[model samples]
Target: MHDQDRKLLQQMFEAAVHAAEPGAAMRPFLPARPAGRVVVVGAGKGAAQMAAALEELWAGPLEGVVVTRYGFGVATRGIRVLEAAHPVPDAAGVAASEALFAAVEGLGPDDLVIALITGGGSALLAAPVAGLGLADEVALNEVLLSSGAPIGAMNALRRILSRVKGGRLAQAAHPARVVSLIVSDVPGDDPAQVASGPTVPGAGGRAAALAAVEQFGIALPERLGSALEQGEEPPRPDDPGFARDEVHVIASGAKSLEAAGAVARAAGFTPVILSDAIEGEAREVAKVHAAIAREVVLRDRPFARPVAILSGGETTVTLRRTGGRGGRNSAFLLSLALEIEGLDGIAAMAADTDGVDGSEDNAGAFADGTSAARIRAAGVDPAAALARDDAWSAFAAVGDLYVTGPTGTNVNDFRVILIR
Candidate 1:
């Protein structure tokens, strides 16, 4: 029974992820062949795949560069595919950003720049501001990641620190008509928030970025802090630089959840789409989902049995105690397992749509009636693991880690609970 449940959950997850693949989802949204040069540039987990999709559909001559997370690249002709670090910016990304900007150089109003923006683009398009270095930016990113700040807050801080992000990229390509195709990974599908709005106009200014640092108690390096406080603000919505730019969210977490729902319905289960914009600390979100699962199983108040509850959106993890290894999805499943308390007739799966959870090889993990017991039997304490923020180790000990390698796409997290 547990094996059957696992298979069903995995199938649903794959369906959700497959729905967001750039190859299939991005084609219809591709703009018509440009009248002049098409300077293709992009950054994100899915940028390479998005470029591949563009190459397949675009007939006109085009040339450009795109940077993707390490190991996420695919072979493409005409457009250069460069691999770079993710979750944190590295020197390679810095160089790639320079190349991307150069591709748009000397463009006129007749020329077009197709910018592929998606999750992780902020890191992949890492171009530190004039006063800061790559090391300074990396340090700041580390602080923000562990600070448990929401993606929006972290991105606002990033926008202030970057030269290529927060609408500056669009500004640099002035006079060239820019078309951005984005894959949304954040709640609300704010184009400006995704990838720090490289081509889209941004909302917050330096003041907001400073506020995030204070709110999260993030200690900025002295130099970086000074830059944020003293430097000019990033471009705002009314910036004329974005007048010739268009941004489109071609794929998002909501669409992925809908795809999962269809798969659940076909499998004789009623699927309830909880929300595509769910947010909070990873473990806290798990508890809420568990409570809903219990309600359905114990009281049948919200929905009947044989139902699947699906949710998407990114969840943050505040690192309290270090030395624990795990991503948000694995941490969420570990917490969910504890709350369920080995309840019978319930199974759950939590995974990142991008195929790597919290910098680990596993996309996420599965938790069923036997998960907690299995971990305990293996001499691993579930509560202890959660306390250390080490859900990866807990899932690993139980042989439940869901490794999907690189899916070449990212729409944040995908979570589902099945009550039978």
Candidate 2:
């Protein structure tokens, strides 16, 4: 039963990821080819795949550059693919950002700019504003990741600090028709929040950015803080530069969750999509999911047996200490495992749709009622691992780590719990 449940979970994850593939999602959203040159600029885990799909679809001449995480790149003909670091800015990303700007520069109004934006662009397409360097952006990402602030708040702060983000890229391509096709990983599916709104205009400006800093107790660098206090705000929605721009969210977590649900139903389990926008700390969110699964298994209150409770969202992990080895999905499954230990007829999987969770190689992990016992038998203390934010180690000890190489897409977290 455990083996079957794990297989079903893997199938659901694959289905969810397949639904958000750039080849399929970008097809319906592709803009008409312009009489003038079409410039493609993009950044994210899926940017290379998006560019490749565009090359396959568009017959006209298109040339541009896109930046994706180092291992996520795919071969493309017209659009050049650049590799860069993710979740942190590197020198390569700075160069890629310059390349993106150059790609769209000197374009006439007749020319069209198709901006393929997705999650992870904030880090992969790094261009720090004046008075800040790549190192500063790297430090900022580290702080934000460990601060327990939600992705929206972190992006709000990121938008203010970046030169290529917050519609600045669109501003750079003034007079050209900019059509942004987005794969949203943020909770609300706001294009601005995804990749910090490189094409779409930013909202709330410095005030919102500052508020997030204060709320998260983030200690910004003295220079960065000063820049936030005095720097010119990003272009607003009313900015004439964006009048010709079009934004379309081609794929999102909600769509991925629905795809996963269909797979669960086909497998003979009634799938209950709890929510696609769930947020909070990873462990806390796991507690809630565990509670619901327990209720369904014990008394069948909310859902009866043979049910799959599915959810999709970006859950955060607040790094209490350094040296942890897993991402939020693994951490979440570990917490769920502890909560449901010894509870029969329940198993779950949590993974990032991009096939890499946090900085780890594994997409996520699997857990069952016997997970805790199995982990203990492997001579590891699950509670201690959880306390250290080392959930990856716990799962690895028992061979439960779900490692799927880059899936060429990013729709954030995909989690499913099975009760039978």
Best by lDDT: 2
Question: What does candidate 1's lDDT look like per residue over 1-420, in tens digits?
Answer: 278888999998888889888888888777776667889989999899889888988888889999999999999988999989988889998899999889888899888899998898887887888878889878887888888888888878878878888888888887988999999999989999998888886788888888888887887878988888877788888877677678889899999999999998998999999899988899999999999998988899689989999998888898889789988899899999999985889988999988889788999998976788889999999999999999999999978999988887888899999888
For candidate 2, report its TM-score.
0.98
- Candidate 2 residue 66 C-alpha distance from true site, Å: 0.4
Report the C-alpha lDDT of model 2 over 1-420, residue by residue, as the tens digit: 377888999999999999898888988888887778889999999999999998988877889999999989998987899999987789999999999999989999999999998888988887888988988888888888888998878877777888888888999998899999999998879898898888888677889989998888988878888878887788898887788889999999999999999999998899999888999999999999999998988899789889999998888888987787899999999999999998999989999999898899999999999999999999999988999999999999999999999999999999999888
Candidate 2 ranges beyond 4 A from true positions: none
lDDT of 2: 0.90
Every model's Cα RMSD, please? 1.2, 1.0
Models 1 onward score TM values of: 0.98, 0.98
lDDT at position 74, candidate 1: 90
Worst 10-residue lDDT window for candidate 2 reads: 151-160
Off by over 4 Å in 1: none
Q: Candidate 1: lDDT over CA atoms?
A: 0.88
By summed lDDT, which 10 consecutive residues of candidate 1 come out lowest? 27-36
